[model samples]
Target: MRVVVGTCGFQRGRRIHYRLLDAVEVQQTFYDPPPKSQLESWRREAPENFEFTVKAWMLVTHGYNLRLWRRLKREVVGDRSAYGGFKLTRENLWAWSVTLESASALKARIIVVQTPATFRASEDNSERVVEFFNNVERGGFTIAWEPRGTWWNNRDLLEETARKAGLIIAGDVLRERLPPRGQEIVYARLHGLGGAEVNYRYKYTDSDLEMLASIICGGGWREAYVMFNNIHSFDDALRFKQRLGGWCGS
Candidate 1:
């Protein structure tokens, strides 16, 4: 069991919150790119045992709303003019690899590419997916895919493809979006056991934690990366980590 917690932004000396855990998922990269200095500073802050996992940028995930995208563009590129020219091509993929390599120096274990809900399962998108994987293969890092919407219907094929490409599926306990239970290398994002309509701030009951612990421990995988996505003001993830630590006697 490799437990991880999601962080909203980079904060100096904040690694103490997750020092007891195995890993931390830096969600800042999903919205904005952090400076190399900040990333290296975090690497120096944590103990050698700690690992980092970063969320893929929204541009890569196609999670752009006009206002949010523009805001992110201004923050990242210093101008909105570069936003329109931004394209998801092989070159952009290479750029992402460079960013991940910098993160690798900080001991990042996996790069999570969480697709937006709009990206449905279709043959057209499938090919693009394969191409994206090919482009990211240069960095010698692990890639985890988390697709929303009707993608789970083609779970078998997608799992096979992911395995062949040496990518990991980002499993979650959300309604109807769970990935296959067993894989040699597994990475999961536990967003709480609630329906889609549920608010992000909803706290996880003991039952919810127990169910997730069961799946993780029962799964045949030698190791699993479990990160909490229910980061809505409460420290449910940290509490859950403490509970899981006790259960696993870690």
Candidate 2:
């Protein structure tokens, strides 16, 4: 298996990150997408084989009430009432268009659509999840769904929907397991296990890294993406690559 390890964002500066790791999951896109020119410049500056993965904008997954909006720039103006919920509304469509454009600029291989804990497992929500993916123009990029809360309870529904829409189920490998279906590509995020939901400050132990490595390499997937989201993400990811005997790459 081709297991590539990297941080969720540029924990180090871009130049250092690009030189040390072969992959990165751009985090700013989740809050505020950078200009297309900037993303294109990043693509130009990185190594030819460097791989980029983009986090889908919150406008497509989060509700307006969520505190995540506080990080959004004041200059970003729009009637956000119709945003999020994965609905087939014009606002959500526009949000997706921006995300697609950003990914296209970076030549990213994956776009991670992360939903909040409130986005629970229900018939209506499930239907919308499938419909949104089916309707969106993915721009030839793979879509990874990182769902939170009770969505894990109904694996059958999750598996069926993913198969129908061609999605990769993303999860914190330490907290949850990736669905066995769609093993062609596995996306694993390592958010520290310190708290109930997610604790970015917690550091991973050596044993945790070993288990994580086991899970990624044990799978039948042809490729695996391990993105660390903890405080020591960069150091941990570098250690993870070393543990894998340096075979992991973009």
Model 1 Cα shift for residue 178 (angstroms): 4.3
Candidate 2 ranges beyond 4 A from true positions: 74-78, 246-250
Write one digit per residue (lDDT tens) for candidate 2, span 138-240.
Answer: 8999999988888788888777777677788989878865756556888998888868768999888778887887777777788889999888999989888
Once superposed on the true structure, which residue ranges of model 1 sit more than 4 Å away at CA? 1-13, 73-91, 174-182, 232-234, 245-250
Each model's total of backbone clashes: 0, 0
Error of 1 at 198 (Å): 6.5
TM-score each candidate. 0.81, 0.93
Please give the CA lDDT of all the candidate structures.
0.63, 0.85
Return the number of clashes found in candidate 2: 0
Give the deviation of candidate 2 from the true structure as CA RMSD: 2.4
Candidate 1 C-alpha lDDT tens digits along 75-151: 44323233211234554554465458556767786788777667767666776677666645546667788877667
Clashing pairs in 1: none
